[model samples]
Target: MTESVQQLVRYTRIQEIVGDVIRLRASGVALGDIAEVENTDGEVSIARVIGLDRNIVSLQVFTGGKGLSTDATVRFLGRPLDVVYSPNILGRIFCGSGEPIDGGPLLTTDRHVPVGGPTVNPVMRVMPSRMIETRVPMIDLFNSLVESQKIPIFSVAGEPHNELLARIGFQADADVLVFGGMGLIFDDYHFFRKSFEEHGVFGRTIMFVNQASDPLVERLLIPDMALAVAERFAVEENKRVLVLLSDMTAYADAMKEIGVAQERIPAVRGYMGDLYTQLAQRYEKACDFKGAGSVTILTVTTMPGDDVTHPVPDNTGYITEGQFYLHGGVIDPFGSLSRLKQHVIGKETREDHSQVMNTMIRFYSEAVESERKQAMAFELSPFDKKLLKYSKLFRDRFMNIRVSLGVDEALDLCWKTLAECFEPKDLLMKQHLIDKYFPDIAEKETG
Candidate 1:
């Protein structure tokens, strides 16, 4: 005799009681299916049966216990939540649920996969020594975004962090670009798709988007799905993948919500104590797998109220190698740092890259101090005067976000700018480098 099968059951008046919980036994037919519970009001929520005690199963609902009722009907979908993944995901807009909000095709590929899994193991990782040149002066010359380097753009809302990320995707020398947009506004998402398409780079780019209007659960899956597919491309296909995630604050918020649903005790600012570990799991995925392609991550984490001390950014700063702080409509040189820059600063780039970058920034910083002195009517020294002059030239030539230059050209322009503002001796760079790279500015200055 065959074992009897459990029949499906429905509850009609789930909202009649308060503080009531319903338990169901997995019919043993669909173990991994995300069980759906619907209330009499036609409201639906997703829950996972984490504990099964002989006949009764314990489920954790994503939305928590506020509106659910004992009378709610439960149905199992026979599969864990999976995202539709394919090459056609390029140049299209999607909501948090992986649904095409831009009215595109359903992405009917057989390549769907589950998101939010454990990160790559340590034994499978490789040291990150490659450079991903974006040709953006602020990145290539100054901060030097390294391959497999996990970095964040610390910016407040209304800044051009999205635009910067889009520019990098368009220009960066990588085989594939995977972009994950969490809690992005519709306009911003459209802008990214349009920018890539117009630049003719959309074919090599794949976007996983979670908009502000989508359900919160979808936001949690965006990063995982992106990193999972990226890992496959890198390790299996030997493709250099660059993953761009915008507004990680949204991802943090999703984690916080899940923590609340699980009734876990909150740590700083109502965030789960595992916040650091969770972030590390994703960021550590930036690796150069041995004998294969690499995955480099550049994410945007918007600081709420411009507070770097906020829990989200504070934890992020610790986990990431360095940060690009965006402020006042520009990448703030004083606030940015790239810890992995040494790997490529003087190796993959021009010999003068390190010196030129440091000297220009040092002078630019002094120029800022000189401007402050001028504001207070203090007498300016000769060096201060030179600093003020060089600062203006520096801002125009290199600091502008719209400015573009190859690594070599940028270094040459640095020499030109320094020659125009100060004497060769005053540049304080090695005499040998000055002799080799300094343009005819020395003769022009002396004459």
Candidate 2:
């Protein structure tokens, strides 16, 4: 016997066709309702109900309106988009529409959960208390990545942000990794999967991919799909899930395109006025469920031409906790920040983590000034010469971007660098820390 498919009731009135958006006089249709548009050639495509004004509705065709005439048949599916949620979802890769494209069996026999719903209730959320060690010195040591934190890697085109995300997915201590690749090239998508599998983390990894050639509408769905699975993992399975969303600027571009198709008025930089709300709807999904595991989000937002004030990064900076600025092929220590790092830095990490972080950054900042003086050929003092040496050592040891060290290793390296650049009295750490952590300081004092 064959499985029966429910046939939806169809509508024939097509009022207007502008680009991929179709407008029609309709009733009993709700926003976000799934619709099917059939062209004159009997080819059908799936669309979403994006705009519903009184009785008239506007639908965005996912596959785009290519061959559809103004008289295309419209069928309201009476539902929004949903994904299959189960333990079987792990070790699987799906397209933006939640279809398994990895040559695997079709997903069945599980719950169908809606995507792009409201974020978790703030009352149910607890203060994030755990640290998610990415094992990257720029993050784990200096700026910690706390659980339930929503931060972005701010980079431009041609940067190694994808490499950074892959490293985190491979090394982060989270129980499950949910990755959403929006507008990625085929190579980047393949790299993520292959790297995860090679690093032996693919079993707990679920990927929702929207390639550059895929429909723009799909890009908007990738984040929601990934976050839905992360939520299920965190709340039900009690798993600490980390969601990695890359190239959110592409998602924003897709939203802008759809907004233009809907004839909506554009806001700042030609983006929709509600860009912040739209971004918050997805990013606010990062949460720590009470007594359960948390869902931490780390997304990549590529700035256009490295402009931070661009509308996408501008709105994103407001929504996300903080940003990791990826410039000069590295995570710039001066530019990147984790606002929630203070919550878990010393509490969850070592006894000297907070002090080491402060001392290293302060010294590195002074080193930068010393280097500028040297570049200007200014006569340098003895302290300025020491600052120059410390800065160069800091860049090579910590800021090299490829310098992958654990938090403990990074802290140890900080002391070694300080010992190389300064004497016992020159290091301004607490006396107890100096007595305990800085053996070289005591050795210098004895000598």
Candidate 3:
């Protein structure tokens, strides 16, 4: 053997096998090191070191250990997993294992970069003051998605959160889109691909998907692979990268399953105690490089049974900047918030943007109260009838997830809805904006 190949280490004994994990006595092995396991039938599979004792290492096999013998040969790779990073990867799709599954030519191995590195330092990160306009009125006008912000779409099953995610991916003004989907059905996967293709954004998009039928371990790798590539693009290429991850709940579940397989103690709801740490390690990747571009993360976190207190979303709420609450086929403005909106609302947007957002939400809240009163058979007041009219317009124009409009257009629609519902004097807005925005209303009153 060559001198380089002679230095490789191999072990042919397996101490124990449980679920998809195998335990063996091996010295000089670090956690997260990749190992190639060749079964007795001459079939090779991948495994990663998940635990380490004094002289024993526990590896989680990528391919489940169903028929493997105890004497399967283990070859340590002395490195963690990595993904391909190059401009050629654009418009390509890869599996969670970082292999090209789109029938494309195999990429050269020279550009591989390791995944799951420490996050950018605070001093290297710039303040998130820029806005990423998705053209979704509810998000752009109300809860603006700021650059380098990490947020999630809080939803339940059967909601169109995936559609909303794809819409933002294609519509958001970013230089590149990195999408990661975990445990998605085939149809949903096809839909996203078709959406990006039809909207002409596929050329600038890179997808890392793990379907429901794929290996569960691969689900855990999607976020890391996607984010790793995104970070490279933002720093190396100096491009604004938007990363959209769907169903982070599935990723957490995969971790729990692996934890169970390893016989580790479970935390709240059968999850490992380090759930928050693992999630933060990935989410902290969102950063605006000081002299380069930015990476913005928007993920879909489904709350089981629509329970906000569920561990996954409950923990996510504390880590993310804010969440876009997707319920009842729309983004509930009351439940959704952007804590960083103050950074960009009036700075990047129009001067009237802040006042318009505040006024629209206030009237919508009153409209909701009017709806409750009407439902209770209470006699509605004259102004309550106007509020009822504003509510329907707000839903159809802004709240519906399908409604897409620029920030200025949505602000104009807000003014139009308010003007059609009430006279200029009835509007409790700043006199300057009211008169400047709708001079015809003021002129009629003065005349």
Candidate 4:
């Protein structure tokens, strides 16, 4: 990386200060350039040049511009935002500004990589084929996670999105985990850290958190820092890295707030016009390197008012390969999908895996119909009664998010649940599988 040039400009005349924005008359100020504002009390704060029109430049002060006057000075750092990248970054906790808040040793390396770097070239990206098993049947058996695939968990506010993310962090088949938490509450942060420690994966996980009490401007830095470190791990170290971001809605809110402060025209739902481009810039970072490790992104996008049309989720749906709809605390199989799962499901898993997945879903769908029939007090067929029983078993056995079953064990349990509910002929499976897995249910049945 080339060394960043420091412009070192000082402007004392402040024209306007409104909502963490400082406007002044300055020349040669480039957009995205870092700035330092020294108040009259000799205290300095960091900022970045967000807008420049004619001789007027506007900087978004990271300190929220609490107290300022014409006596304040601004220095334009020639480079955009940056963070240090090294192996030492693992197992460390940093604030949204990429500074260690855990009182740990400062980054000893002098190497600085700019944040929000460009996406990888399509030519450099290999087709993703490997599966990332989390041992959750809903994901492993149904929507298999593929390496380098960008996907999101569509959920609402009260859903256990964070807990689900932490669960994946604990169990995902990755060499490293990078978690970026934006606008998170203190209790949520504590929960994540404690859960990681209890699960014994905290040592391999790196956390960058922007708490609710932190400056909103800094919330913009979490994704960049998390992705920067994860990219370094995947490229330099050749480690399979999984990046998990919670509540991207909060990040979008931060962007909206900053845009409002900048006086930019709002787009749909008061979001910026560049929403898609900005979001793609980050999600596109998920890539599978040709002979190296991959970086897979699994983010949580909380839809406001549970509306999928909300601008944040609406724009996100276009960028991601598929989504895991997390409704009612369990991953709704009807709503969740893995577009890339086909690349690895049958090719990587057992032969019976695909057949079992289809059979179970088919039965589950029929079970839903049976439930409707029962609700309307219609006459129930023997098969419908069986489906009602199977429905309860399926939910308790598999759909329950709390059920912790490995992929292989979950597949075996599917056969167990089927044999207990219906005869082998009722399964509508291939005769070979029926004979192989489903023993004579009649003989096993108690009179």
Candidate 5:
């Protein structure tokens, strides 16, 4: 590593004040040079002189004020923030500061790039018609995961959202998986790394982690770094990439902090007014680029205090195509949905897929109503009694997140479950589907 330390003499009089702002006069020849300020006590921060009036130079520090002094030495690095990018970055773990944390040697590649560039234009986007199967029953059979789809897991803390993400990372059909962890606990990060490795999928996975103890500024860079690498792989290498970001609530929190630092006006619940726009920029990055591979994003957005009405989840609901609602250790059939499922459910999957999915969910919903009626001791019809029975079976067989099945198997199971509760004629599905998939429950009943 090359070290070039240049001192800023004029910065001697600089004093770190409230709000982390600093006032300095450039008395040395290092005016306009990027400097890293450190206190005599060995705390470090990066700052750039953004304004200069006469001999006074104004520097904006990346780290918010907590420790500093007039005796702090300012060393100018003479460069802007840059990230190393290359194929060699694959299968490696990097910290939020873009440093390798996987006990590997630093990449000496000259392919350094800046993060947070503009998104691709809409005209450059191709229609997303391809499906990316994760083989998780809830996703594959019911809510189909589509290529270039940007979906979020709307969950609360202590939920198995991270485990769900790791499962998808291990099982997703994409060629590459880029995981960005923001404000994740050490245990969650370890779980993801171990899960990928144990499943023999680590070589195809790239992780950029920002733990809760890292600097706040670094947390803001993790998503961009992960997305930037994913975009490169999708465009240049023509590899289908799946980007998994855990706890986007932390990303939004970083934005809120920056907004407060910049003295911006707060919108709903003290979040910046540009929250929606900022989120859209990142979500829209999920695109099928023309003549290239696609990038799909599956993010975990934990609702604060289990409040979906909170700004983070509220804005996300509008921008994302759909969401997987993780509650009570299950992907709620009624709460979860995939808007793009209609595009490929029947067309790309088995003929009975759409019918079975819809019929099963419809029956499940009716079962809920029937259960309520039974609870109230209402006079229930024979059909209502059947629905109540079917709902219980559906919850046990399908609603459990741990239940894994392929599309065909899930559809077949759906048919068997329905047959146990309702007659074939009462299913209301198409005649062809009824003839093709209905099990021989009639023979069992007669026998």
Candidate 6:
């Protein structure tokens, strides 16, 4: 029998209920198939099959399984969870269950697409060689987020990672923006929606939010829904889509909670053994489609207690291309890296881009060393004083997250900062770059 025929199968006996997970004996059930569990009281709850064991199947209720009795009827939908994808969804907000929460008109169901589908085939992927400028000096001049690259912002609790993410959402040069907030508090959710609206990007953005008070199973749906819509926009509409998912640690924790309810064997830190696989499945959805547009993923992975060794961040470090380390309210130049930056830096940007980037970082390293010497009360050399000056200028000009500048503009500012702190000879950059792009302070005074 076909899947549609299988949809007619229904069972009235629920064998077990553990937390939000319910198990029943069914023969024609498939994993990821949606089902309706109707209570004897005439209320129905939606659920999806999560596991199978020959004749037994486990389903996770989208609504908590509270007050659900053993006699609840299970009628399989024979299809996976789907989200609406159309121009009507633009500027709209959805909850984890893919329902509209923005008080907008209900979208037609004819345009719905299944979530959690397979990643794009390698044959359909194109090389990512373009840069997605965010106008943030640190990322534009230093890390250079590349199109179709999957990277994360490694942050800790109480940091402004969401603010940075929101800044990128409004400032990034992309055709569409998809924002997913997993386990966010009401205040953070309000901030994101308000930021996009105030910056005038809300009209081109789609949001999938799962608040902290929502059902645990629904938190798992946010990324899948956002990515499903983003993929359609990139492939069908041929638009460059940027996806931002914040606090993936909460997503992982939701998985762990479900795993514990299902009594699965635990891996390191009580997380499921498939944690890496789950994360890779989502991150790999980022791709530059051949002969079409691209989908770039930038996520926020919070490391608990500032510990990188935590399972969520540790597993994430292996899956993503690179990370932007956010610490002490700034993107740490020393810890942040973009492995694909070589594809665009100096090629898509100004020729002086690479030289200025390397020189600024080198001088900043020395300046940090100079800071240590000053702290120890050691005698400071004349050059150390210059390094200190350069350090302060660099922090104010480029390191501050709020400082925004175009790539070329930031490069010019780099040369100015260097010239003010040291002579042209002091900079080890190529003479050609210095001669061509370097400022002529002496000639200016003479003129």
- Give residue 115's error in model 3 in angstroms: 0.7
Please identify model 4 stretches exceeding 4 Å from their true place: 1-12, 108-110, 439-447
Across 1-447, the per-residue lDDT of candidate 2 in tens digits comes to 222223344476688988888899887777877888888888988888889889889988888877679877887776788888998988999998788989998878778898878888889899988899888888888778999999999999999999999999899998999999999899999999999999999999999999998888888889989998899899999999999999889999999999998889999988999999999998999999997889999999999988999999998999988999989987898899899998998788889998888988888888888888889999999999888888888878877666778888888878778877886578787888876777565654453
Q: For model 6, which pairs clash?
A: none
Runs of candidate 6 exceeding 4 Å displacement: 1-3, 6-8, 442-447
Top TM-score hit: 6
For residues 39-122, write the lDDT of model 6, one tens digit per residue. 999899999888998888999999988999998898887778999989988899999999999998888654889999899999
Per-model C-alpha lDDT, please? 0.79, 0.87, 0.92, 0.88, 0.83, 0.93
Worst 10 residues of 2 by lDDT: 1-10
- Misplaced by over 4 Å in model 3 are 1-8, 439-447
lDDT of 1 by residue, 1-447 (tens): 222322333222332221223356445534334667887699987765443557655555656567676778777655566766666665665555556776766777548877556666777777777788887888888999888899999999889889988998899999988899998888998899999899998888878887787656667778877887788778877999999998799899988876675456999999999899889889988888878888999999999899999999999999999999989878889999999999988888888888888898888888999999999999999999989988888888777777878888888888888888888888889888999988785555663
Regions more than 4 Å wrong, model 1: 1-33, 36-72, 75-79, 86-88, 107-109, 442-447
Q: Higher TM-score: candidate 2 or 6?
A: 6
- The C-alpha RMSD of each candidate to the native structure, in angstroms, is 4.4, 2.9, 2.2, 2.3, 4.4, 1.8
Arranged by TM-score, best first: 6, 3, 4, 2, 5, 1
Give, for candidate 6, the lowest lDDT window spanning 10 residues.
438-447
Return the number of clashes found in candidate 1: 1
Model 1 TM: 0.86
Give the TM-score comparing model 2 with the true structure, all chains together.
Answer: 0.94
The prediction achieving the highest lDDT against the true structure is 6
Estimate, for each residue in 175-202, the C-alpha lDDT of model 4 and write its tens digit.
9999999999999999988988898888
State model 5's lDDT. Answer: 0.83
TM-score of each: 0.86, 0.94, 0.97, 0.95, 0.87, 0.97
